[model samples]
Target: MSYPAAPRRSAVANAIYGLLNPIPFGFFVAAMIFDIIYAKTGTILWVKAAAWLITLGLLLAIIPRLVNLAQVWITSRRFSTGADHVDFWLNFVAIVAAILNAFVHSRDAYAMMPAGMWLSVLTVLLIAIGHVIIAVRYSTDRGYNHV
Candidate 1:
């Protein structure tokens, strides 16, 4: 007899993933701020470097997931036995967000000019919201006891 498939994530899991999505977003925002600060005051080269380093760390953390997704694409195989399409989509979105962050940070820093702080704030807000949603979803999926 064939065994039944595993159950999909509960509501709690979804909530967890959603909440966690903002973490990277925050990093990106901070990186942008760092770039802006450095541009304005080039004397603190170390500070500027530190800011970029943090941003790189955040991107690196997500690279594994990105690579895994790519591998799945190349292999033409199901990434998961469960309904993990959400996971894939969110992961891809995170990668996109990171890239955008990198671009903005690099541009602002290299130009040695102030970036649109208002736009940066808006972007951070959006990313934070995405993070919360993803955190909720993923946590619930992982069977995290939300109770």
Candidate 2:
């Protein structure tokens, strides 16, 4: 049996992915920090705004990342190995966590939920780790540099 060749991504696309991929995580961390402050001091505006902004950013980033993942998957035609696998799942979890943080946990400012705050923080950590793994892999992987 034969499989389709992997879709080749342009260097610009790879660079764009590398650059913009972590932005939502930064926003997520900021939002979580704001949420924690709100919990302590009873301020709501910044937390709400941060949460919404991170949500929007996550939604935007997920699309291109998904496309990238599809390209990777088509190239490999099997379960991802090494950093690629880890990056994929970490990103997937982060996206889900971001959604939960924005829609479920972020709905109210009057009551601060520990679960939401922690989830957002966890999402940030996951994204950071995933990015690090990918960056390290990219530095060593010849094919990654070619793109």
Candidate 3:
């Protein structure tokens, strides 16, 4: 007996997904740097603005990603496994951390500093690891070039 062929996404859809894949990570990194600067410099308006702007960008990027993942699941009848799944979870964790960080920052409370800073750090580290995993997978897998 033969197994059914896997559902295929359109080339345009795949290309869009590829183009958007790294964007949130980029924004996360920028936001993390700005947050660190704000922490050190103590409430510099521009730094805070930059961090918030980048965080918003990150959130915007996440919407397309979630849609893409949903499309994949709808078409293929299964969620991705291995590296793709790991990347998804990592992004989820980063998004949650960003939201928490934003909440703490908005409160403008001194007592929240430790929690907010820790969440920011966690977000950065998770995004960095996720990026590294994607890079390694891209380098090692020739098949991804076709996608």
Q: Which candidate is the best by TM-score?
A: 2
Query: Candidate 3 on 41-122: residue-level lDDT in tens?
Result: 7775635664575567566766666656675456543635477667767777777877777777675544455666677788
Give all TM-scores, in the order shown. 0.41, 0.75, 0.73
Q: Report the candidate with higher lDDT, 1 versus 2.
A: 2
Sort all candidates by lDDT, best to worst.
Answer: 2, 3, 1
Best-to-worst order by TM-score is 2, 3, 1
Cand. 1 Cα-lDDT = 0.51
Q: Give the total clashing residue pairs for model 1.
A: 30
Model 3: residues with Cα > 4 Å off, grouped in runs? 1-8, 77-79, 109-112, 143-147
Judging by lDDT against the true structure, name the best candidate: 2
List model 2 lDDT by residue over 1-147, tens digit each. 455655456676667776776676677778778777867877667667667777776767775676567646765536355788788888888888787777755567665467667877888888889879988876775443454
Against the unseen true structure, what C-alpha lDDT does each candidate score?
Answer: 0.51, 0.72, 0.67
lDDT for each residue of candidate 1 in 19-136, tens digit (9 for 90 to 100): 5544565565675565556556674563456347546646554644544454335443453423344545555665555555445555534453343333344445545554566567
lDDT of 1 at 6: 53
